[model samples]
Target: MCSFGLKAALLGGVFGLAALPAAAQQTKVTSQGITPTEIVLGTHQDLSGPIKSWGVPVTNGMKLAVEEINAAGGINGRKLKLIVEDVGYDPKRAVLASQKLVEKDKIFAMVGPLGSPTVLAAQDILLEAGVPQLFPVTSAEFTYKMDPKNPQERLKFNNVPPYTDSVRAGARHLIQEKGLKKPCVLYQDDEFGKNVLDGFTQALADTKLTAAATTSYKRGASDFSSQVAKLKSDGCDFVVLGTVVRETVGVMAEGKKLGFSPVYFGSTATNVVEVPALGKELTEGFYAVGGMEIPYRDTAKGKAKEWAETYFKTYNMEPNTQSALGYNDIMTFAHYAKLAGKDLTGQKFLAAMESGDVFQDMFGSPPVKFSPTQHLSATVFLLQQIKDGRWVVLKRDLTN
Candidate 1:
């Protein structure tokens, strides 16, 4: 009987030993880019390219957020570190930069990567590695859409209103409120342009109206003579621009040269301080649909005034809408990261984000929220016009 009892005890001990690894596996944290004292994040931007004007301020804004957060003790005691790469606004270069960030740097996530084409080129690589692409600067709808068959596509989340929705809001305002008919479109032949065109077309369809003329241009083309001529010839009284800052200015200037003075509408891409600064007199009376509140320094009050003041003191430059966006993106990420707790993981952060909790930004615009199905944070936008050399808020919370 003693011998039998000894054998049974030995068998029980062996079973317990076998279960140890399974228990450890169940509790082991599966997060990357996290150290006991630091969490590493990275992004690629157009630091030396055509859009550097937009990229520089955005990078600065993100850095400012990192500084403020780290100074305030960071998220759950882990300091945040941001690594930025210059991609020159090129897709191939963006892909290469993303590979380095993922493979060499081993970043936890990507925040505020600029341009739709660049993001599209690098998205698959990051998604395949299960890294969260958080709050990319582009508002392309694909940034937030999830594919049920491919769960990896769910890794991307966007804080800005999609380009489609922004265009739709602008179109609705122009057609219904402003009494503008004879609409025309000048769009780039790319995903960004296509999304804007789609929204404009959908909005017109909803109103049973048709665009008078539509023209496309190659991306990064400087001269807008032909496209502007086509719209002018079509007698387009209201033109929707699917162009970025430079293109927006170029097209409007070309129109001005030809003495065509139709009302111009642009997506959030054109709603930057550079538009007025670079375009000068030509940008006057231009209207745009923006996902966030216009960061007008002179008219700012309350939280926005304080934010602008702090931003100016920190960066030695006035803040624009892009700056506001960058600051909001990092703050939003940190908020969710904090909610994920001290034992943070990418999956936990994602779950916290998908919990549909509303986040208040520094500018006191509308609260942002996300969910499993709805990954885009802001669906509504405000319409603003460049009046007297500054962006003036014309309408708030315009939606289609």
Candidate 2:
């Protein structure tokens, strides 16, 4: 469902047990990952690769959740066992890693696997084996947008705000609020980039505006002089980006070098703390839309402050946006797993997820809800900007 090169980055309640098929139940009832002592879940991350920036912190977050869950006497007496593999953000490695997880580790579910290409490459293995894929890191469309004809699609669920939805909200808000006349997009020529491009196009169409120009760069290219120059020459008043951490900073830096600054905007992925830290002054005023609020210790209050303190004390490093997500992903999974109770099977777990229960995180993200038909979570996104080398919220609850 996604076109990719290198990337970074539930059932239930309403339908009840009757909605689950006998074949699926038969395949999962044995629950390979569930033992008398523990429940095994697997994840693949880019520990030794490019996006390890995301993978390492996320893994740390998952560990925190598992530690907390297990400390509470584990989930219904079954301690959580998370076996993580280093996929290096490579699709081939991801497939191999997944095979090991399924065949050897015997993971009942795949949680927070990183990278779009990697997840896509490895997903079929898990699905065919009847292992549930929960909350893989990439926010690409296919992670949750399933074909109704395919029953196995329900086995895949996503929590991160999709790239398309966040971009749409950000683009529309910029055009109207900033009075942008000529909008354009400089996207990465890959799955993640294409999703941003689609969102940009859709946003322009919604505003009854047309794109001034659109250009793309290769997946890992650093020099965006040509793309930036093209957008500048086209007189684009605003430019939507389909870029992650490094590329986001690269594009803006190039624009600064050329003295051609427009209203720069990107998806939730660009709303990361890394951009500001890396880009320094070049990234100031850069805007992006995000679902999760960045929780800084000084600014955070109550549970958020408490969580940050706990995270730092545990990891001996400060938490960033990715850390929060990683922690939330496993916590969210654990929440449903707990609801699944002692006789946790694939169907019961799926049911618990779709039971329309509201999940709220300490980071002040939108409450997540899943249903039999709706798997994608988080409709609201916050529009943020970089000011003085830190991300500041500009607007909240941006929705189409």
Candidate 3:
């Protein structure tokens, strides 16, 4: 009887030893940027550059989100902190800023870093360090596309629909629904512009249509005379703008000057209040594709209205589409952070996001979903037109 009992005890000990590896595998792994009391994230923006029009408001939106989250007892008892640096819309400065954030500040992840060139410049360094690049502002396709040759490229995620997809939707609408032909494109000579051009080209191909003309301009060029003149000469009935706020205005203003009043359609880059404010009456009748509904102060309802009111109270200014975008991205991050559990790591945070959860922002538009292969959330867009110095919803959610 004593021998049998000892054998049983030995068997139980063996079973417990055999379970160790599995338990270890289930244990959470942690790394830098997470402390007992906080999680640190970083971003670089064009604080004093040509795009400061967007950078300042986006940063302000992020700050407000962080403030609200921290005030409400933080995320799982760990407060959130963001470290922002200015890259002045320069890729070299972006690299330097990212190096400081990763090597010196030791940020766990980068959230809402502005500009396609800036993100492309710094992505490799951050990904190599096993840091997640989360929700960069630009909709450049490379920001989220996984390289077939390298599976290690899974650390980057984009919250906005790719410029390709946004343009495709708009192009389909213009060609099929509006029955307009003679499409032309005016794009910047960079990744951001390239993505939009790709989308426009693809859409034309898909619909058995062809471009009347395509023109490119250097980044930060205030004058778009030659490009606009080319589109005018091409007799394009509709012009797709691969431009941001100022550039969009510049191109359209140039077109207006030339009496070239083609129906202008722009990607999400031009979907900002500043466009209308800067371009004034000239921006009127322009169309843009956006992933989320713009919360117009006069017509916003329910949660959007409340958010706008609070934002106005907090920032003492009106919130635009960019502001809402910045706010939504941070809030989405917070949501995934909660799902990542208390022992949060960059990998865990990413896993939480890729777990196929549907996320709906303050606006009652479509939900954003992510998976291993799909990183860009908010795949659909609503077509909006500027009327009476404001964006008026022209069409509901559109997908290509």
Candidate 4:
């Protein structure tokens, strides 16, 4: 889980579901109804908070998928009923929002809940409710560790590969393929940063290469001149960053000012629209790995392309990969929900997801697949670099 400050954000209002015996069934508001009229599903997102940049567009993408599905005669003659609540990227807000969705809205499943911290806060709630949270937006490790023996009792039905996987792939490419002997890391001092560092360290276990220096920063800090100066003095040739847009640009600019430009690498969160637009030259040649596919209108396929084209034509703005990721997540859930058919229970929904079928969606390079044991799908990531004015894929697909 590479979320920056989601845990502390849940201080006041966050509430865990009441602990009950394993045999206890979640109180369903109404009887199971999967007919020709409606199939209700719920989601939580950050519409107005630190991560709104990723949340708003993703919600739009989910809406688009629901609209398209409804238009195409619905799923098994039943229209999808989606209920979304704003979590504001706060774990407390996420808990409250999810509670409303589960207790009041009576949704069958949950989709997004963007931040890793937020998703973690709702884990017990969803599990206690016996509702399958399909394709949560965050990649936190605890989000997928469902070993009951381990007292922590984390769930493992996440859709995307863990953030550790992305970091491992990128770090291997940097050390083995790119041959950077003196690598450093500019990481936010949080769970997200630690996750990336764990992967990077694990990848460099056999090799002699070590992180020459490590710098930690807060999320909203504006200046990084001293940190970059320290990196320059450390003689680090490459730096892997674990931060978001504002901080990422600030550090790179500081590096340039200190006359110490290294091959900058970062987490998937760097794929923000403001980076290239505002940072300009500072963002060039920076690399990151992401679960989303490139947003080229021409190369897209089937309903995916059609959705992109229609979105562009209607809004007159280019959609980023986040939209596609959101679209794919919701669509994939709907596909399984449809496959679940009349027996619309949480176990049935989970079974449908783990049916060992590779589904081609508008999200990642490789299609998504699940097995009885494997809960995570879409293991492949695309390594992209900012070239010219846009992000171009450096490699087609790097399966972790």
**Best TM-score goes to which candidate?**
2
lDDT at residue 243 of model 4 (Cα atoms): 76
Q: Model 4 clash pairs?
A: 1-140, 2-192
Cα lDDT for residue 324, candidate 4: 76
Where does candidate 4 have its weakest 10-residue lDDT segment?
A: 9-18
Residues 147-249, model 3: lDDT tens digits: 7455446677888878999899888787888788899999989999999999999989888889999999899999998888899998999889999889998
Candidate 2 — what's its lDDT?
Answer: 0.84
> Which of 2 and 4 is the better model by TM-score?
2
lDDT of each: 0.84, 0.84, 0.83, 0.71
**TM-score of each model, paired residue for residue:** 0.91, 0.93, 0.90, 0.85
**Between the candidate structures 3 and 4, which one is better when assessed by TM-score?**
3
Question: Which pairs clash in the backbone of model 3?
Answer: none
- List model 2 lDDT by residue over 53-164, tens digit each: 7888899989998998999999879899999999887889999999999999899899999877788888889888888889888888989986655667778889988888
- Which of candidates 1 and 3 is the stronger one according to lDDT? 1
lDDT of 2 at 56: 88
Clashing pairs in 2: 12-351
Off by over 4 Å in 1: 1-30
Q: Which residue pairs collide in model 1, if any?
A: none
